[model samples]
Target: MGDSASRSRVSYPVFQDVNHMVIFGFGFFLTFLKRYGFSSTGFNLLIIVLGVQCSVLIEDLLIFLLQREDENSLKRITNAVVSMTAVVISTGALLGKTNPVQLILMTVVEIIVFHMSRWINETFLQVPDNLSMTHVHLFGAYFGLAVSSRFSEPLPRSEKNASTPKSDLLSMLGTLFLWVFWPSFNSVLAVDKSKAIYNTYFALAVSAVTAFLLSVLTTKDGKFRMTHIQSAVLAGGVTVGYAGHGIKYPWIAMILGLLASVISILGSYCLQRCLNPALKIHDSSGVHFTFGLPGVLGALAQVVLTVINNWTNSARQGHLVTVHIGAFCLTVSVALITGFITGLILNLKLFKTIPVSKYFEDQLYWEFPHLAVGF
Candidate 1:
């Protein structure tokens, strides 16, 4: 009756925004694949389920053990959404590579590692980041990429992960869902009348457009690639997450969006044409461009904005610089090492797993009941 009566609940609309983003946004986003629609959406559903269940338990238990308190229902739900989002980002890099059961197991190990990293940085590293670009986005991308590199099998060049008219249309539904609600997604945590939210909303719109235009312009023959457009348009949200609270100007948001969109398109090109093969990593959803590098850009933006805002605070500046560096090193090292170990454990073959050749297609897992096959 003491603190319970006085505690404020998260706004209903904010919770709803994050909810839709996770469900419709992430699910449909993966459906862009031409052949792997079944596996793509199905696997996403699986991981979300698995990740949610395990995330609650792991997070709550850690809270009890470490903080010596029990979490309330609302907090658990909110944190569960955040945890699932991180898992979903990680899954993008390993899409079509693992079966339902394998992905479930991976979720278990991943939640453990994910929470551990978040806790260490928050509790010990004292990093000025909560859902910071480095913590949530980059951490998942690098972790998934590491796992993909170690154990993921590549889709053959002859294989089709390309988009069909219907598939592409469906994919856009996912994009639209994500794009429409993105402002809410970014601004939900901010105070009312927050510059962060304002900047975030505008930045999202600008990036989406810039990403679309740049995607068309940057292709080898100047033709638009769906992958680039899909991945890069979201970079705006990532960039503005840096200092949305302090960034009072829309032009700055535009500039950041423009730059992030360019980098995202370029990241897609290089990752697809060059890095994937040379690095021996099979990134199924091209998450590096979409979520990974943009997040890094966000981290950079954080530094730039901090400097521009408070250039005269020498001692505070020194402390922030040190914390940022430490945070980066900690996030990268833990993500890579922990992800590699998780992949190894996933490779143990205790479970009956699907062959790598059957990676992307839907028949291996989901049942499609309605299509009439011809002789």
Candidate 2:
């Protein structure tokens, strides 16, 4: 009995407190960075990020709050309030802006950010642990890459199907609220009106076309399907982001985005099928390290794309070829090092901690009885 009790104690919830602390610390650091670099543009971007974060939190909070009541009615109320607030704020801010074009551009960017955030939260946080990490990561990567493709996939029934039409309407309104704020998130930084317009429309067009194609090819049953269009959009966007200012080859952006989307989907599938089973770990959280690997790859891709574009442009202009090699190297090195250190700190539990509530256990049983068996 004593030995059995000790073993049970050892297995009891050791990670929750640590996980909470790491998340809060990360949020604090992000907040600090934003404030330190505060400017009109920076402030707006920070708000946009915060808005995305808040949107998720609000949804979760509303659902939790309504769980004991009429789930349908409470959900409807939550959606309505969230949607109204978003619409009011966005409309007010854009009104009387110096450049209507800039406002419109910012709105589009905000929509992308909003969608990415939702996709990450849903694919990573909401799913059962039995689902492999590769599955979650692939979902997230493809979703992000799909942004450049400009496609509108249907919301998951889990996300969209509420108890009532009113609830569904509210949920959609909240989504639209996100759509309205998206463009402003990044486009506010663009100095040239023409460039801003081009970037905004271009991103939207790519995303829309990719989404449309996916919808056409996908079966009516709504099973998620991977395609090359998603990769093309992401790669294209990354390429354009690196050198769009100087390069006239906007098509390069689309091509690269398409390629990235394909690679991301295929890589994720391969990782899940080939690598995950061998490791014996299921669930995305268990494979957190794998998810982060793409960020490193993305940084490298950005560097290579930027250098090539710069070199090509410089050759055409016959400019003195003094590269800011030190600055570029330092930036990438610092970013990589910082990311590594941060991951280590979180894993090591060098910061504060939080305790998962016992109440959550009941929730696990109620919402996912089968999953509750494993816990």
Number of the top lDDT candidate: 1
How far in Å is the alpha carbon of 217 misplaced in model 2?
6.7
lDDT, candidate 2, 1-375, per-residue tens:
686667445423222222222222111211211111112223334443444445445555645764623333333322222222221223222211112233233334333333333334334444211111112222222222222122122223322111233422332343233323323321222334245335534543464355445534444665533222322223323223323333345564454444444444445556557764564322211112122233234334445555675675766323211222232233334323432333233223333211222211123112445656668
Clashing residue pairs for model 1: 196-244
* TM-score against native, each model: 0.90, 0.36
True-structure RMSD for candidate 2? 22.1
Q: Give candidate 2 misplaced runs (Cα > 4 Å).
A: 1-183, 211-222, 225-239, 271-332, 347-375
| lDDT of prediction 1 | 0.74
Worst 10 residues of 2 by lDDT: 29-38
**Candidate 1 lDDT, 1-375, residue by residue in tens:** 556634434355666777788888888888866778877776777777778788888876877777756756665665677667767888888877777777887788777887788777777867533444336777888888888876656556636656687877777788778777777766655444367678877878788788778866776688777776677778888777756666867898888888888888877778778888898888877778888888888877877777776689988887776666677678878888988887777777686555676666776665566653651
For each candidate, the alpha-carbon lDDT, in order, equals 0.74, 0.32
